[model samples]
Target: MHRAPVVLERAADREAVPDDVWVELRRAARELGFSQIGVADVDLASAEPGLLAWLQQGLHGSMLYMERHGLRRARPAELVPGTVRVITARMDYLPRATSDGWQAIAFERLHRPTEATVSLYARGRDYHKVMRARLQKLADGLAERIGPFGHRVFTDSAPVLEVELASRSGLGWRGKHTLALSREAGSMFFLGEIYVDLALPLTPASEAHCGSCRACIDVCPTQAIVSERRLDARRCISYLTIEHDGPIPEEFRAPIGNRIYGCDDCQLVCPWNKYAQRASLPDFDARDAFDAPSLLQLWAWNEDEFLRRTEGSAIRRIGFERWRRNLAVALGNAWRETGDAALSRALSEAREAASALVREHVDWALAQRDTPALEPGS
Candidate 1:
């Protein structure tokens, strides 16, 4: 059952949004495609230590932006001046065509070994654009009701600790995989935040429900999840393919399987995701090109075709270089797993014209044909 809309109470020195106003905010957010909304106080002092520890361990890989922001990521008031409260939102992103047993379906993609498995999230339009525009509209609706207030919006931004705010504001609990997970919505949704000067009443946080389940930790392809709520991103395929600019690490290449972009193995195995919801908007619908594409098929795309096909998609942001690099690694894995001559031919053909970084990966991929497969856990 939906939690009743929160009642706003007057606090000294700040205008109190009426209970009816809170109802209007909920209505506006819902109309804007937000599944849930909650307020979190700006004080995130307690989360700073964990953020610092994660960065100190060099687990963030080459994503220096996480360290550049420092503790400001935990302290909302520091990142956005005068922000007294954060309005956190969640929007489910599972494509509407998602079927029952979707997790099993995702697992089946891995078994194919030759198919290019883009993470489900990136299979649709760029969610950063979709979520930002909707968040701004939600903010505008709030302004229309209570007059203009100081506010800024963020969606998957580096400077903001999104899961920290989302879990603290009753959106969900931070799962063992370190992504926000909800009992009702699972971990499949995207999160956004509006930093506002208003001192809105804070919502009670959600309780941890992961229990004794270690499915996420056990299911990771590269063991990126070192422990509960701890991730070593250097080994994470998502980080390597999308964020890391260097050659895909040899240790992780084979384990990355046919995932040409981000990996969803953890979320795919989480039992709670059985409750994942379908998106209310068509903006997240999967494009035909991403639905079970082959390694050679994607590798066949020249830079121009890559640019044209990935226009307005999140995959484009990685640029053609990393795109080819990731494809090279996946093609290598496909060749190793299937011994398919077509994949080997595609890898060799691309190597001739590939950039230095991509060519190195292409060379590595071609060498996979000569390497014998190791037994599980070897």
Candidate 2:
């Protein structure tokens, strides 16, 4: 049923939106390519203590922004003035061609050691751009229906507690690995939120389905999931490879394997991921460059080639230095696994022209030549 536009005299207040508006909003969100939308009240005071505890434990690693924002991350109203409710949305990001037994295929890549494995979510377009743009369009559609209203859209922003909002809004439950997961979609999705002044009906939070399931915790290469729902980002491969700008820690280097961008082992091991959905949009299709490219192939690219190839992709955000740093570490692991002499020669050649940081990593990688060799898949 098509409804007439809701005219408002000024920006919406807590009592402004009717129940039907919520229904229309969901319909519009579906039209705009979101898989689910849920409403969370602005009062997130209950989540503050945990947030503080995580920071106190220094679990956020070098992401000083988390410490700077502090509890403002929990309080939506403080982050965005006048926010009475938060609208959380999730978009399934698995590429359209992700086939059956995809998890096994991903696990197989770990055994090869030479093939660079970018995270499935990052194998395509930059999701930060895709989610933010679509979220804005969803907000604009809402405004067209109920007239202009105060709102802001956020996608993986530093100040937003996205997983909290997602869990509270029934989009999913918090997995033991600390990522939001749902029975319907598992953990293969991107989360975005819209903070608004309008009061919307809150969706019931989903029940935690990870009961007794420790697959994610056990599969972690670095044991980053220190405890249930508690992540030590400093030990996390995803954090080390992408967020931390300095040298890759020595202890975790061999465990990193071929994951050059982000880590997906936890998600790949989860039993529920058998039901993970494919993206409805073609924007997430994996480019040929990331389709099982080898460590040597990636190592061959110069800074200019790296920039040119990664122009529109999220991999570009890590920059050439970190990219090379991660590749260096993975190359070292590959040498240990296969004792490949070509990899050693490449690492040696790159070291002469490398920066101090990259040179240090390359030297470490060259040192791996003396390490005892192992059979593939061992």
List candidate 2 segments past 4 Å from native: 1-15, 373-378
TM-score, candidate 2, is 0.95
Instruction: Using lDDT, give the best candidate's number.
Output: 2
Residues 234-266 of candidate 1: C-alpha lDDT, one tens digit per residue: 999899999999988798888888888898989
How big is the positional error of residue 26 in model 2, measured in Å on the Cα after superposition?
1.5
Candidate 2 lDDT? 0.88
Model 1 CA lDDT for position 239: 94
The superposed Cα distance between candidate 1 and the true structure at residue 85, in angstroms, equals: 0.5
How much lDDT does candidate 1 score?
0.87
- The residue-by-residue lDDT of candidate 2 on 252-353, one tens digit each, is 888888889999999999988988999988889998899789999999999999999998899999999999999999999898878889999999988989
